[model samples]
Target: MNGANMSARLKDKIICITGAASGIGRATALLMAREGALVVATDLQADTGAALAGEITQTGGRAIFLQHDVTDEDGWREVIAIIRARHGRLDVLVNNAGIGLSGPVVEMSLADWRRQTAVNLDGVFLGVKHGLPLLRQSGGGSVVNVSSIAGIKASANAAGYCATKAAVRQFTKAVALECAAAKDNVRVNSIHPGIVETAIWDSLIGTTQGARGTRLEALTAPSIPLGRTGTVEEIAAGILWLASDESRYVTGTELVIDGGRSIA
Candidate 1:
């Protein structure tokens, strides 16, 4: 390893993150790069994802951006194959791509529910199913699934979103146990972030504090025990620790970065 990499936490680690076009995914991609990982940042939004990859490289970090649709199985295959070809091994997989669909359960259409489920739950499933082998080939790795506070705590008008995230939470635990049982040395976990202002909110109707049409601050501040929304960088830091060797002994656990919203 180079002198700078010798002391880096994720030096030489081959890391892949989905939904890297914006929000938490973008923040994580940058953070992982800063820690010496070669980042594969994929997203459905090609332009933004490519920009993220470019930014990383221009700043002396290694990254590649691929246009990816998390709901497509073939996309997952192609992505994993590309990584295997380029790096020959996978060290970390961050299933951070998710969508937020709101409105009352009755008002939500079947199509909307399925779409939400496909992106939020199935995306994480496909990530684990496809990425696990390469991680195993690398001798061991970590999979960080980005769930939400909704997964831990329910709210009105977000039934579809909540259901999918909750599934991710339990699914993560089950997969973690499967890895442990097989003695593959792979660890799987989930992150539940509270009210952080991100692109997801652009489509998400604020359901907190009954302030449906209020500003983001008014909707989030009073409800959160910390009196503020969480930041994408804060969430990224937690993900970095889980991805690095620092959390070697942690698995099948949730690292909630929601600033006490889950408890409140």
Candidate 2:
């Protein structure tokens, strides 16, 4: 089969991505649009998500922006209902909204723990809970959850964040098995990223050092084994593969895009 005809893999497929205001989520929206998916770019930042959707529209790609708070089950349900009503099916669901909470467990409060899990773990759970039916309606689609290298391994002073991300990894596996066992034609997977140069990283640095200039570069270049942090586009490409038919046999796998940091 011609690659064009055979692998317009996502042509006309509807994909919904959370956290689309910036970082990996934004990148995925653009990349998926380029690959012929009807992208729904959503985030709490209404302005940014709208701008991204507009850009895609200007480029002659189909897209919509929905304001979403991942922690709100009602919001997630609304999103799916609207998508189904408007677009008819949800082919790909990307759970990409997350926050970076840094502090030692001893100093971390219940609020901190809850906040992290609410967005990272519980948010993913909600997506799967609500999205599975839609994905099955598409005759089997991919669910890509954004995890972290921190999920696979622990870091110093990031107990709450690590715990939530770890939950996402395991949750993806468990859910993938559930889908397969039900033979529901829905695939679930996770992406584990290391120090990716995202707005989240900038915000984390701003919270700590009060300046993201040199500190950001140092974090990107020094610690990672590849001598550089991953890019949002790089991570988006991984998501595209998982969401596309090329990865049909690849469910429940964690695609780590951390510039080889996990190898070290």
TM-score of each: 0.94, 0.94
Give the winner by TM-score: 1
**Stretches of model 2 off by over 4 angstroms after superposition:** 1-7, 207-213
Whole-model alpha-carbon lDDT for candidate 1:
0.91
Poorest lDDT segment (10 consecutive residues) of candidate 2? 1-10
RMSD of each: 3.4, 3.2
Give candidate 2's total backbone clashes.
1
lDDT of each: 0.91, 0.87
**What RMSD value applies to candidate 2?**
3.2
* lDDT of candidate 2 over 1-264, digit per residue (tens): 123333365898999999999989999898888878889988999999999999988877789999999999999999999999999999999999999888668898898789888999999999999988888987889999999999988988888888999999999999999999999888899999888766686545663434554577675677777788777889998999999989999889999998788878
What count of clashes does model 1 give? 1
Residue-level lDDT of model 1, residues 95-133, one tens digit each, is: 999999889898999999999999999999999999999
